[model samples]
Target: MGDFLDKRAEHLSTGMKQKTNIARAVVHQPDVVVLDEPTTGLDIMTKQNIIEFIRDLKADNTPVVFSTHHLDEVALLCDSVCLIDRGTSRFCGSIEAFKEVGQSGELNDAFMNIVKQGTMHV
Candidate 1:
C-alpha cells in the first residue's frame, strides 16, 4: 500500500488519479464498488486497461457500479446499464438490449435514440 502510494502519489495524470481511486476503493475488499466517470480523460489503451481491471473484479463477484458519459465504455464494461438524462432514468437494460435500440451498432447512438424519444430532459 505504501509502495503504491510512493510510486503514484506524485505528478499523477487524470487517468492515474482514477486508477489510484479504484485501487483505494478495492484495497479494503468491499462487496460493492461504485465508480463515476472512471474513464474520463484516459487514452484508449488506458481505458482498455481500466475496463479489463473492472471486468476482472466483476468476475471475482465484486459488484461494481460505474457512471460515465461514454456510452461505448458502458457498452463494453457494463452487464446492465441505467441511462440517466437530466436526473431521470431514460433507459435501463442489458447492453445487448440497448444495442437493439439503434441501427448503427454504437451505444452512443442507442443512447441518443432513447434520449430523442422525449423521456429525458436532455
Candidate 2:
C-alpha cells in the first residue's frame, strides 16, 4: 500500500495501480462498493491477491458490486449474481439458482446456454 501513500499512482506498476484503486475505493468504509473488472489485464498472482482482498471485504460485511466476464471469479466470490445480456437482465438470483438452470449444473455451461439460447427461464 506504500505506492498509494506515496502519491505515486502514475509511477506504480499495473498491479500496484490496481491495488491503489481498490484501496482508495474502500478507504472511507463505504456501505457499498462498485468495481468494474478489477482483475482485468492483471497477472494470475495479482488477480488472486485482489480476489482474496475482496473476500476480506466480504468478511467485514461490505457489499460489493462488480461487473466481469470471468465466471470463475463469480463462482468463487459471489453469493448472488445478475447476468445481463445486451443491456437486459436475463437472470438475477442466488448462485444455487443459477446452477440449477444448467443441464449439468455448471456455471460456465449455464452462462453459455443463456448467451446462446436466451431462453433461460429467469
Candidate 3:
C-alpha cells in the first residue's frame, strides 16, 4: 500500500478496502477495537499479518473485541470468549475454563456442549 496512499478507497480492491477500514479504525488508537470477520477472505499471508497485528495490540494493552466464526482463530488469539447461540449469549469466560468443562478437554467439544445445552451463563 506504499503506492496506494494517494488512491481513493472506491478504486481499491476488496482486500485493500478491508485493510483501509482497519487502518481507519485504529488510527485514533481507541480504548477498544472491534472487528468483524477481519480475515474471512484475505490471503494466507495477509491473515497472518492481521493476527500478528492483533497480538501487537494485545501487547500494547489494547482491548480488542473481534467477531469471527473461525474457531481456530479464537483458539489462537482469544484469552476469553463469549459464545453466542441464536442471538443469545450462552457462555463467557476464560478459554482455559471453557475447555476444562468439555469431556475431551477440547474447545470445539466444549463449545458444542454449550450449544447443545443452550445454557445461559453470562
lDDT of 1 at 24: 79
Whole-model lDDT per candidate: 0.77, 0.83, 0.87
Worst 10 residues of 1 by lDDT: 1-10
Which regions of candidate 3 deviate over 4 angstroms? 2-11
In order of appearance, the predictions have TM-scores of 0.78, 0.83, 0.88
lDDT tens readout by residue for model 1, 1-122:
45456674567767677778877788898889988788887889988888898999889989999888876677667888787878788767777776775434788787788878756321
Displacement of residue 113 (Cα, Å) in model 2 is: 0.8
lDDT, model 3, position 118 = 70
The digit string of per-residue lDDT tens for model 3 on 23-60 reads 88899999999988888778899999999999999999
Model 2 scores worst on lDDT over the 10 consecutive residues at 113-122
**Rank ordering of all candidates by TM-score, starting from the highest:** 3, 2, 1
